[model samples]
Target: MVSPSPELALHGLVLLGTDTVYAVHMPTFTAPHDFQAVLRVTLDTDTYRTARKRYGTSALFTARPRTLLLKDLQPGATCPADLYFGRFGRDGEPLGEVSITIEETVYVGHPAAEPRTLRYVLFGREQLYLSHVLTRPPDFDQVVTAQLAGEWWASGSGAETPARTVTVPDRPDDLTGRLRPGEQLTADGTQLQVLAEVYLETADLAAGGV
Candidate 1:
């Protein structure tokens, strides 16, 4: 089982140049018993259009050189665009470091069209060398949850909620929880509900961080 600590939390963020796509991971609530992780993303209308013009109509959005900003990146403000993983003793001493390497591909479509399919696969790891100060030998167990939201490149597509209010559960395994990847969580312009739990374990925290 993943050991729980004040510093075991990890945040990740990504930004697309063409559009002001902002993604963040936030630690909503935490306690000795459980913790909550929330991921959110937003796309700028103007920039999204520019991306469509430069990139051809396809199914995926490629990577481009865009300005990435880390806003209010506190312990859990949101997912940090830059991956920062470190092992600190209960006393808060650095035991390791965090780094990331990205591989991306993009597919574009018509001005008024949505790509039939858009897919991006991120593969990498974060390494942490446990120091002797750690209470126990690293057991190689960590739980991380990520959430993603993006605006449709085409306007009036109604693909995303103009504004969404997500209610995260105070407990990790609570039935009423926020939406997760692979899980179909949507608000029918009314009440929000979890359609499914498709969010899988995308990364391993202990052995080879994903």
Candidate 2:
């Protein structure tokens, strides 16, 4: 009879200028004894989802970049892009040092599947914009504005919200919790009514509602 294949130790290489961006190893939520390793690999070299696997009782190697370029990136803005992944090339060069191991023995319960909260995005005639995704009601003395200010390039695409005078019905007399879909709000002398899903058709932005 043939013996079962021996479980092998995990080994990997995280190359720079490649898609393998981040790597992590942690215990599975359901079974604390079994550990899961995750690798945050991106298609366009952008940080996104993770590649997870269960490796029981085996040595594993993981490496991730020291710095990321898209940490502060926005939809239509440029951020200081700097990358640091330690020394490379030639023999005897140090690539970096990484050690990942699970020490905890507790198994946290699986998280509940909560629905996503939809955001209310408001845009102007050109590329100007404002948006709100209020999950909780504001306090009695709280006053809401258009939030931060930024610019968007596309002619009719989405943009960041700029500072402006935004008010709902009854002004200070009414609370911001009263704001609902189809309700109109005056934003910088412009009347913009909130809707469920607002879609802007353009090649620069996605055709789906923003």
Candidate 3:
């Protein structure tokens, strides 16, 4: 369950640069120092994503020499820069801490059927599926979508009214709520919907499907 807290996200941004260059977070300066800007990015290392999982690292970088300025930081306005991070400012105030638990993957998927061919994907390959599966009372087939003309990427925060936007492809499928799992719901024959559900085999169940 990835309920993101503003504070931890800030820390994640900071830790992203500790080993090599210092990272900065929402920075405030006094007087003349304001004219100088800082770079939002630093020389990143290969182990970049791995370092993001650590906690307890301070989100506040002490405004060091290694950090460069962008264009003289502005009041009430900031640019995205790295090299540690200047943050200019944060999107929202810190909301508090988040805890995560990791173990073998629990998954939901549909068995392949004729016309659909065999198809299975790692659960929650995209954040959207995770949001649905891990939240209170998960339900599937809850989205309206069509087959895409070609491969596409979904964009946008998963919480908004039009939360998911399908990318444009060579052709597009007509949008329809009637789309069903394993149905070739797209135009180019490249898109299909599959019903993903948590499954239990007979061996895992108590006697007589109890």
RMSD per candidate (Å) reads: 16.9, 20.6, 19.5
Instruction: Judging by lDDT, tell me the better candidate of 1 and 3.
Output: 3
Better by lDDT, candidate 3 or 2 = 2
True-structure Cα RMSD, model 3 = 19.5
Over 1-210, each residue of candidate 3 has an lDDT whose tens digit, in order, gives: 122122221212232223222222221122212111111233323333333334212232222222233232222222232322222134323322222111111221111112311122212211211111111111121222222324332433232122222222332122232234444433223354433221211221111100
User: How many residue pairs clash per model?
Assistant: 17, 0, 20
TM-score, one value per model: 0.24, 0.23, 0.19
Per-residue lDDT of 154 in model 1: 41
In terms of lDDT, model 1 sits at 0.23
- The sequence of per-residue lDDT tens digits that candidate 1 reaches over residues 17-36 is 22223222211122111122
Question: Model 2, range 50-82, lDDT digits (tens) per residue?
Answer: 221121111122233332222211123121211
The lDDT-based order of candidates, best leading, equals: 2, 3, 1
The TM-score obtained by model 3 is: 0.19
Q: Mark the 10 consecutive residues where model 3 has the least summed lDDT.
A: 130-139
Worst 10 residues of 2 by lDDT: 198-207
Candidate 1 — which residues are off by over 4 angstroms?
Answer: 1-10, 26-162, 166-186, 190-210
Q: Rate the local accuracy (lDDT) of all candidates.
A: 0.23, 0.25, 0.24
